[model samples]
Target: MAGSNFVSEIFLFPLSGKIAPILAMATEIKAEPAMVLAGVLLSLVAIYIASKAGGEFFNWLGFPPVLGELVGGVVIGISALNLVIFPENGVDSSASIIVKMLELTAGLAPDAAEVTFQAQSEVLEVLAEIGVIILLFEIGLESNIKDLMQVGVQSLVVATVGVTLPFVAGTAGMMGIFHVSAVPAIFAGAALTATSIGITSRVLTEINRLNTKEGQIILGAAVIDDVMGIIILAVVASLAKTGEVDIINAVYLIVSASVFLVGAVLLGRFFNDTFIFFAEKFKTRGRAVIPALTIALFMSYVGAAIHLEAILGAFAAGLVLDNLHETEVGRELEKLILPISDVLVPIFFVTVGAKTNLGVLNPAVPANREGLVIAIFLIVVAIVGKVACGFSVFGLGNVNRLAIGVGMVPRGEVGLVFAAVGSASGALSPALDVAIILMVIITTFLAPPLLRVVFGEGEPEAEEVPETSG
Candidate 1:
């Protein structure tokens, strides 16, 4: 708590002077509408650019770009550089910034400005939420539904063992060994269970082992990991909202999420011809991608309508369109979705990064030590837990146990998605959120080099057909 408190005050004091005058001046301005739009646009640009810079820097270092984006977001966030809207101390953050803007433009007193600011922040939060949903949506599109069928029993065994071991180990380690409470512990465990299909598959593709037995197992297991992780997320989200997990509630979420996922995919497949027919009728190139985008949004909304995360619905939507890859409609849809994903997904990651209040990491404050220790503990579990999955890859030809194990290690986007929803639903406290992100950061960076060792680095023949991120 001390470290958390210390961090909050760092930016709070500077904000009082720097931001208040801008608000007051903006309040005095006659052009209120233009200013608000300008303010929002400026904020959006800053977020994207900062995120990109961080992502690229990390990429150059041989780590995943998303990892850098998260780190960049934290650096520019209100906690550190006051780059984002909200500050930890709750002094001169979003609400107050809004208050000043309104006061200058609307000529209201401090109180009125503050109230209006609160309302605006809720909208920004929703935007940030949607960003992540779209992210998972794109990830789902990359992994797709057909991946589940290609690899067979060996992959299933690897996936099942891979998923189960990490989860149990994470849960048990937190609750039994660390004396943590169950709800948070469950979430902490859930975070450890995800594997980054996009990153893993890309590595395998690079090594030209994608068609190999071990490669199939790794990719298939990663896909299974994503699906299982999403269901677990739904369960944890329900508990986060209620401040605890209940057996009946958990059961309902699991069943409902499972049913919705299967139903969405099946319904989409059954109607795929109709969708293509409707899509084909369109003459305007400008509007061609709408049908696919519409289905994605519709599915996402339905998932939320049933109390599951919109991401689950989005994932299913992608699965339904899995075969669209070879069609004109698929090409058009990809053109539309990839840009949207590229723009919005970084916002989601940065927001997750912004959630960290680095005060907890300050050495002067003893409480930060707890966060650091827990993070280290979780990182160890994330590695060992995934490494253990290599043992389950039975009946495979020339399997690199180390390679499969290393491939499963990076949590990447999926881990961040889990962390975001958990934080949003109140499953993770601020400290725990930072801890999860730290684990993601470490494992994401560690996985690539270790994988290179197992596969050996050199260009291989280009894949005839790129494997799905799965």
Candidate 2:
């Protein structure tokens, strides 16, 4: 009864009043700012421990470390340990071990627990958003525009086929067979379009096939897939936000994103010298990276200002900076950016895992049965649609069409980005979100071994190398 009253107070009153039950008989209280900060600090500890442990464990097991981070998040999140939780729907501070620890040790009054939890969760979410922006920026820096252009027609065909098949099939199936609403179906379809360049590239490099013909096509096609996936992501996210599509708005986003990408590339050629000169002039410690980040942030702002996703801007900035990446300054910039990525990027992945409720997959729950069926359907579509891209390769004799198709299979971190955005927008029901997440996990797990089998390679040589950061 008391817990119910507390929940009512939280819902009925403003934030300031929500913390008052202990301080006064009436519902009015001033929260300690220190308590909120304390909560954030504690949450970070949990996030980092989970991320590192999960990553190292997965890396040891010959899987992508990011997957381990995801599973780690699952272990610590609402679905498991409850070390890190959000105040979504029926969830409250009572379910959070972190909040409980705070209450026990930090003199955090019971009445203020909810407010502190809300504040901390908001901070973590901001960190996760920043993490993804940096992630796209890093992806841009690594992609070779010249090389991607060289692969040209074959890659373009593969990327187009890869994106189109999954999107058309997934969206149509969701609406026609499952009777899902259009926007959610579109978001789900968009999620299917992502081909994780990071995971694919790592597998190729490991098997000494990175320089092979099939590998080049796969890498180039994956880059193109990333770009297409981004555009699709921007479009679907917009659709999900509005809950109804306006043709004008959708077209505007598509045009604006294209112009923004092309314009940045063109404009970058003229400004490259000026950028270097300005960057070199700085005597400060963060000279190289600071200017680069400024560009990324400015572009991100422009993307948001134009009602496109901010990630589009950051990605464009990375492409603009790609030319400079080979220089001494660029090497330094890469070294610097990596450590930052190591710290923040996992937050994004883990948070996505944490938000996921695997409970929805339980067959014992009557409502979940539909979600399970949809998940199976999505898994099949995710595989078949991407594998079909291999058969689309034309005019190349003895090209391993199977390898190229399997290479495009893993959704990796890119798929997670779609899932996160969709879930955040309230566009996906819990069941549907979990379904998408399951598809991502299955695809990510299957692709490496499947790639090895198709390429006829033995186990990868044991060597330490930096994993791709997409």
Candidate 3:
């Protein structure tokens, strides 16, 4: 009887221990999923409000909306504010709910903590990237291709010179000042090659110069510059990934991109004609709405598939359809996309702020000295390199050479894209990353007012200047 009772107690003890673990897991499972959903929704709403508030603040300051958006993001992301929080292992109600739901539905419990974190990060990153792509696309949709073509030659010269000087200067500066490797130096140069068209356009429009020859040329060249910048970025990214710059692969990328660009243009032309013909034939109610959106999506998809920036596809689509006379489709499309652009684009810029860790600027860190010096040198190179591009317009007929140079100044979204990519690829140090972010903000903020002063306010239409002497 005594032996039997001892055996029974031992069995009961084992059962009790197992039950406790099960209860603990059940508690965790109940809490985590709700937390994740709530976090995402809250973050997004907070971002939107911040973006809107930022725009209003910047507008009052006589700056572009982007300036406010960026500042707002930075403010929120600063460690002092503690506004943006990431989840950790603490049994906080919010995080616990998310973990619990994930565990119950997907069997991803405590062991899957890292996986869940990574997935959330990825979703945020992708959303930001898509915002950028769509912003560029909207720009394309609004541009007038016919007017753009008339200004093409001078714009081409400006863009080429603008891109080239920066590329060379930035590369040289990185190599000489930082003593970094050729690959990193080249990447740095590539990052500086991007011109922020949105900022330039806004300044031009504000000055009432949007319809002028110089304005048109600046706009056109900015678009071309974006295309060239993307190609360079792709090549560099490929090199970074493989460590071997395969000429064949590079050429393939170039060819594929070119083909997609050309194909988009041709397809857009064909579709425009077909749509006009069908609209006349069938007297359709929606007219070009369905067709235009369809074309936009198709061109965007094609560009993505070819490893080209979807913005290029959007630009191409715009160029083709911009000539559609007497159609409400163009105007309608613009209206539809404006809200999306306003919302998503700010998110992209804000994400830039979130990723930036200004603590790197602390003088307490020894590495910051290197970052500061490099940043100052790069900023000088960035400014002077593009300023030199004005010389390309020296012989051109009555062009505001200084204005053209200023138009090329702001690195804008393009610079941000480069910095983001570098950070993601682990190609940039933390300090270097922070420096690049500052470069984007400074250049963007300074360009508009400077250009306004140089070009004169209130649109007295500048004449088209030839690229060379007649």
**Per-prediction TM-score to the true structure, in the order listed:** 0.72, 0.78, 0.76
All candidates: CA RMSD (Å) = 8.4, 8.0, 12.9
Candidate 1: clashing pairs of residues: 23-100, 26-104, 26-105, 27-103, 27-104, 27-105, 28-104
Sort the candidates on TM-score, descending order: 2, 3, 1
Enumerate residue pairs that collide in model 2: none
Model 3 C-alpha lDDT per residue in residues 310-428, reported as the tens digit of each score: 66666677666765645665555556666666666777777666545566566687878777777777787788877677667644476677777778889976787787667656677
Candidate 2, residue 67: lDDT: 67
Candidate with best lDDT? 2
Report the Cα lDDT for residue 342, model 3: 67
lDDT of 2 by residue, 1-470 (tens): 43233323322333343234234532465556798789888888999999999988977876657667778888999789999887652488889999999999998999878767776776787788788788767776765555445556888899999999999999999999999999999999999999977667656755666546677688778867876886677667656765544455446556766787679878877656767888788888988888888888899889766655576677678778887865777887888988887788788778867876668667898767777888898989999999999889898676788888999999976897788778877899977887898788788768877887788745243321223343
Off by over 4 Å in 1: 1-36, 85-120, 152-159, 175-191, 194-245, 398-470
Among these predictions, the greatest TM-score belongs to 2
